[model samples]
Target: MAKIPGVRPPDLSELTRAQDRMTFLYLERCVIHRESNAITATDERGTIHIPAASLGALLLGPGTNVSHAAMTLLAESGSTAVWVGERGVRYYAHGRSLARSSRLLQAQAELVTNRSSRLRVAREMYAMRFPGEDTSGLTMQQLRGREGARVRRTYREQAALHGVAWDKRRYDPDDFSSGDPINQALSAATTSMYGVVHAVVVALGCSPGLGFVHTGHVRSFVFDVADLYKAEYAIPCAFEIAAAGYADVAAETRRAMRDRFRDGRILERCSRDIHHLLLPADEPEADDLGPDVVRLWDGGSRTVAGGTSWDGEVDW
Candidate 1:
């Protein structure tokens, strides 16, 4: 069989960096099943293994019960979990584990605040449009075109906030990746990252049925967090892998994605973005995750004075 592209990797340990300075991610990568504790997964190949426990974030949503075996796994890991569209990148301390109450609270507050802020920006984009006196009975075609116009205007305005050129066609067709084996993998992986993030988020309880910015239709929340983290995590990692050049692009894209799993920044990003969960420890040994986990002064390491307590107001 042709080697399938797009390998998804999971960060084994939590790495939280200085708040706001590092890439923050909300973890979304897993197969969520209903009341099933036993996990059976096959790699790109048909080879299958029955895992002793559930994989990734195991969320037993409302009116659901996790199998005993799954519960045991949850108890042992004390892992934070997502509840199939109920949480929507939200994290809940594993019931079996002694969840760091204080840490989770602060993280959740900050992350929720951050998510809210971004969504607010998207909403503002809609509100700021030319809501002037026009033809009231405009057909769906007219309104659809208007919304597209609004989206472009919003993207440009948002891009300007970062001093970047705002254009709809960020990737040009002329500069397309090489048709060789190496570039193909990178391209596929890059294209797939959004879908992957969306899958995980939906499994973790982001209600596509209810959306703030995206329309609440056809699995809406899948790419929600991906929109927030892909640029920081997947984009750079894929660059490093593709630059090395390989025989097969699709296969390699999968490998590069797996490699990205080990990045500390990805973990930091996930913990930072999802609200209702205390942000993880960005700086090792620090109890509170303060703003600016890591910074550069003249491209040099800079540290802020404080302990591991994310106290007071947060402004990223």
Candidate 2:
């Protein structure tokens, strides 16, 4: 039998940073295969090669067939591959996280498990939304109330500014088209936001299930992070798109969201904000992109070197 060589995966530092990559690229009705370091999408039109590391998320819509080699390259490049339904309204699955280190995940777990620390983190999240205002003394209920009012005001203001019909938000996950134009726009916009934020959350070695303000769901932390930029990006973009009276609200919303993400450098901001939330100000920064090292848990305060026998030193 002849021997075949496997493709060498790039070093973490050699790949493009998640924050610097394209927001997302959607493809349907195509066959995706690997060629060297890039993925090629072939269809009736032709074939297009995309550098795996340059992509933040690769959305595979309906009628898409992906080769295993292509997927492996995407994973190694830290580019998230999301399997979604038409217009990206339904999320089916996602690829592996880019994180090699568990440092941020440990910090998230510790903060979420303790009630005081959890509340403090929640307050910090709200504080980001309400700049120039102190939310340190406010209770959870108070924070929710304030946020609700602020969001409502934002919706009303945007509706009025865009000359669109103002109504309460209404969405049915099972039926995306049931809502009005504005509601549909909002849903589509937020869904896109979730996709991008999910990539960042996982790439940073953070657990999407461990959230500060939100709890329980697998993507609670994703929601927590997405909400931070809704007002600044998604909400306004949705309103603007809805007002334009586009026939395809969902499609237009996706394009608008992509532009906003790129123009505003939302990925960079998202990564920075997540780091700020998880890491303490005084704690020395660790190399998130450094080599993967496994350590055995000793206690909350420390960890011992892994892959070594400690039984001889400790007598049973």
Candidate 3:
């Protein structure tokens, strides 16, 4: 079950198929089931069919239940199903990977496994956050300090601009009510960012635990990537949502953050950033290093002139 059973490998033609352009979707109050080629959700009201292929990731929030068949279909369609807590504020578990290739993942592992290369990639990530800045010589500690200072400054600036009282970020995962409005909103915003970043990370065939900066957790890479966007998107959105004085700040913040992610094309940006970080600029292209394949497409048949067709089974 480690690999999707009986699913055909994805090809170039499959990539252009019409599907949901929306990268992430949060849904609740439904029971998901597989119906033929589509996944449908049913509730007390009625049934709503979901085009699983269109989605990058499906956020199963509170009150949602999914069948094993639905999960299978989702995996086959190259969509990830993420189970989350209320308002999609917490990540509980993930279903399956939608990645079609191991090329990028292998590259990420090579970079992460080497101490020197890991440090270089970490610095590269920081440099992207603060464009035009020279972070080449900064140690990990110094990078953390600078990043902390930048985040604090951003919080202060956002609070001042939004006229919201920001004491500090305080939150308890077990007790959400313990945190103030701003902190709660910040948590919600960051969680949303993490979910989206996770989707992109998986889609790009990278291990979530193989983070350049953040470490320890299984989703270390997800945290590392999400932090890149917090200052510009999540932090500001949280402050602004708090300032607006909405009764349901968490929900409103998530809704607004979702809109921001869509407008910012965060998924595409994250994919590009991860690639630039993991793949060295001077590294040769994958095709250049791999076996050459002279492919010929005639009508509906695919012919690899000198190679055998890949069977459905993969080593994983």
Candidate 4:
């Protein structure tokens, strides 16, 4: 594997930052491989070089072939590789992290594993969804009721604004065509947002399954993060795209969603929101893991347990 002369290897640190990079790229019907120092994709159309380091997430849709070398390059570069269905409709898999520290993951697990702390985190997330509204002392069930009402209101508002027929969200996994055009648009838009949030979550060393607001699914944390921006981006974009009634509705929605992502700085907002949700007012400093801290692995890791800070050791 000779180094390509002009291709400078990506700096792992740069991959953590969400700014100044393309947020989303959808690639389908291609064969992706590592050529020298670059990732190149070939298809019946032609060949193109993928800027793996500068991309937030690469959506590998149907009819795509990916090599192990390509995955290795993408993982090292900090760009996520998401295996999605057509038009990024479904999320199936994700590449590895570019993170070295597990601090965020530990904090999230601590909060989620505690019943009281989990409820508090859930309340905090719901509070953000409705700024200036008091959500004090509300139970999780109460929060769910309020959230449902709010979302229903949002749907009605969007439908009224765009004059699209307001029906329940209908989608059959086996038959996507069964759903109406607007539902399809909504699905495409939200999944795109989820993809972006998932990439940022993993990059920051957080578990996508350890979520407070959303639970059960593997991507519950992703849904939790994406919901923060749903009203601002997904709902409105779906309405606008559906109202236009373009000949190619899916393509139109995808393009408009990408535009909205850029205009709204969605990826940057997602990064900030995840940090805010997981790190509270009394969050432990990055270097401090207090008493009861369990060191799980030994590496370049520094851990403080039993009144001592040791290097390259696991304290169980």
Candidate 5:
């Protein structure tokens, strides 16, 4: 197949017809080595082996990385190479040039931020208390009306129902699948962005928890990265999933997310935008705060709010 002269090297391999095709995968949680028709992987649970030949498709990428040994094996065995790594994940130059620069990536990120902020504010302004409208409006009022629940009674029930005492306090509506319409709109917006963020995080090989937004939770800045894409990637996916019978009423799962990510209606240029966001040239130092969004644990997003300060802000 033809190649993009500047595209990152394709991860590939030749399945030796009964001859043995092999691949190696690495991630923060585990390491794996596999070959066509057979497979072996190592995790903290102590390397439980599995049959590798049965899979119809393999979706592997960054945040998860592979070892040099695996790369060497693929090179010797002529397998495809997929170099998705964390921000910290980098291999020395094997003589290949590089992707785009950080300035361009920052620019693209800025553009997406401006685009998404407008959608987010719009969704919040029209927070409706009931689900009277249809799904196509894509308006804020529709989002809030369809998704909100006062939950005042649920909190009261906890104290009265089973002698189980708890604060009858109202919680922040941050859960992606909450009943709040504005919350639903925000969730829809964020879901669409996950694919691009996932790809970028994998390429960076940095901890997804070390985020601009979100806390230093085990998941890392992964949610933060994913949040960046909500305006474009998530809204359409939510509507489609809703249309396909996964209504906007309940929570959506990651499985449903992957399906939506695979859908053809997604804007393909976002892949290029994702790639641009991960340009190796503009590597941020541990102390050097850059232009990316900073998501803190308190559900607030802003570099000025004691998270990593960014170069610009999108005021929608």
Candidate 6:
């Protein structure tokens, strides 16, 4: 009898970078199975093949059944799998990270744990939102007020530009249809942004729970990163879609955001922004932030080689 050979997983270096891959691919009401390096989704209509390496995040929506082999391919390619609710309206959970090293995670932890450094990082985040404005001396309260004004101004401007009715943002997570078209659109767009940003955060080896501005929550860092582009990308897209008065606002919003993300190179910008926020400006950039290597703690910012027998050398 002939023995069946196992499928070989792609090397980390061989996989596509998160920034260069598709923003996301949403699959629903289909059976997902593996076909070599690609994943095939089959339903009554037909089957579509997607290169696992080219996907940044795979949104497994309602009725989507993915096989173990398909999941293995996704994990190996560093593609994040997000299990979401119907129409991708609600987020349930997410898969593992691609990071093999703890360098960025350590940096993030060091910065977030220190009060002064945490404030500095938070200011840097607001500075990004304000662009030319200097937030160096502003207190957290002042920063919050300033950000509130900016967001209000953005909402008003976008509403005016799109000729849509202006109203304060309001949405009910339990009932998607409860909100006005604009609010619904905003929710959908924001959710999509979070999905994409979460993927990049995990891929970079940073702890999503350790955030500079938004603390406590497990996805605090994801929120921090996603907010960086909310004004530039999500808000405008949402307003435009609301003005168009699409029958299926959520679906249309997702499609519009997907195109917007692609054209805007959002993935690339997101990756760069995250690195800038977590890493010092003087630190040199490397192709691989987290290499597939293990090390032993040598104390005080030092590490020794892993897999070594130090039992005899060290005093017991």
Leading candidate by lDDT: 2
Model 6: per-residue Cα lDDT over 58-136, one tens digit each: 9999999999999999998888999998778899988878777676888899899999999999999999998788999
Stretch of 10 with least lDDT, candidate 3: 284-293
Alpha-carbon runs more than 4 Å astray in model 1? 1-54, 57-183, 209-211, 265-268, 276-316
TM-score attained by model 6: 0.96
**CA lDDT of 209 in candidate 2?**
87
Candidate 1 vs candidate 3: the lDDT winner is: 3
Per-residue CA lDDT of model 2 for 117-139, tens digit only, reads 99999999999999999999999
lDDT ranking from best to worst?
Answer: 2, 6, 3, 4, 1, 5
TM-score versus the correct structure, for each prediction: 0.36, 0.95, 0.83, 0.85, 0.29, 0.96
lDDT of 3 by residue, 1-316 (tens): 4876664533434442212246677889899997766789899999988777667788899888888888877876667788998878888887665554566887888988899999988998899788889999999999999999999999999999999997788899987767889998999899888888888777666899988898888999998988888899999999999898888888899899989988887776787777777777786433111222455444474544435555543565
Q: How much does candidate 5 score in TM-score?
A: 0.29
| lDDT (Cα atoms) of all candidates against the true structure | 0.38, 0.90, 0.79, 0.79, 0.36, 0.90
Backbone clash pairs for candidate 4 read: none
**Better by lDDT, candidate 6 or 2:** 2
Error of 4 at 274 (Å): 1.3
lDDT of 1 by residue, 1-316 (tens): 9876532222223322222111111222333222333333322344233332223333333344444444444433333233432212122233322122243333323443476543543443233334463534444356557766654565454445434332333333344343433234335455445434432333233333233345545443434445454444554544454455555544455555645644444433443444322223364323232322442233345544444555554776
Q: Is candidate 2 or candidate 4 better by TM-score?
A: 2
After superposing candidate 6 on the true structure, give the runs of residues whose Cα lies further than 4 Å from its correct spot: 1-5, 289-291
lDDT per residue as tens, model 5, 220-300: 344544433443344444344443444442234234444555463232333333333433436542211123343444445
Q: What value of lDDT does candidate 3 attain over all alpha carbons?
A: 0.79
Ranked candidates (TM-score, high to low): 6, 2, 4, 3, 1, 5
- Of 1 and 2, which scores higher on TM-score? 2
Model 4 per-residue lDDT tens digits across residues 41-151: 898888999777777888899999999888877877778889999777888999876556676788799999999888888888889988998887898889899999988
Model 6 lDDT vs. the true structure? Answer: 0.90
